[model samples]
Target: MLNEEQAIEARATLEELHVEHRDLDLVIDHLLLSPPPDELLVRRLKKRKLLLKDRINQLESALEPDVKA
Candidate 1:
């Protein structure tokens, strides 16, 4: 189980990552609609989206403190 400070930090980090995910989603949507999308831009967006997803998962896991077996 996490202490109070640790839990707070985890929650804050999770919120930040969630916000970043939302921003990335918007960028992806815009890129999808744009005609003749730039290859580099598309690649960057995909990479960022993947990274954000991993980070979000990590943060979410941290937020859920596990009970000791």
Candidate 2:
């Protein structure tokens, strides 16, 4: 379990990651629509975005409570 300071830090990190992910989405969309898109760069960006999503989910789960039946 995270302490108060650690939780705050985690939340901040999560927010930063979210912003980065959103920015990546825009860049990827632009790259796809532009003439002669860079397929390799887009693929790499997509992979990085997925990795960020996973990390965000992990942090969110840790910061929240779990419900039991």
Each candidate: what lDDT? 0.82, 0.96
Q: Lowest lDDT 10-mer window, candidate 2? A: 60-69
TM-score of model number 2: 0.94
Best by lDDT: 2
Residue 15 of candidate 1: its Cα lDDT? 85
lDDT of 2 by residue, 1-69 (tens): 788999999999999999999999999999999989999999999999999999999999999867688
User: Which lDDT value does model 1 have at 62?
Assistant: 73
Model 1 per-residue lDDT tens digits across residues 1-69? 677899888888888878887887888778878987677987898898889889878877777868689
- Which candidate gets the maximum TM-score versus the true structure? 2
How does candidate 1 score on lDDT?
A: 0.82
lDDT of candidate 2?
0.96
Separately for all candidates shown, the number of backbone clashes (residues 3 or more apart, or on different chains) is 0, 0
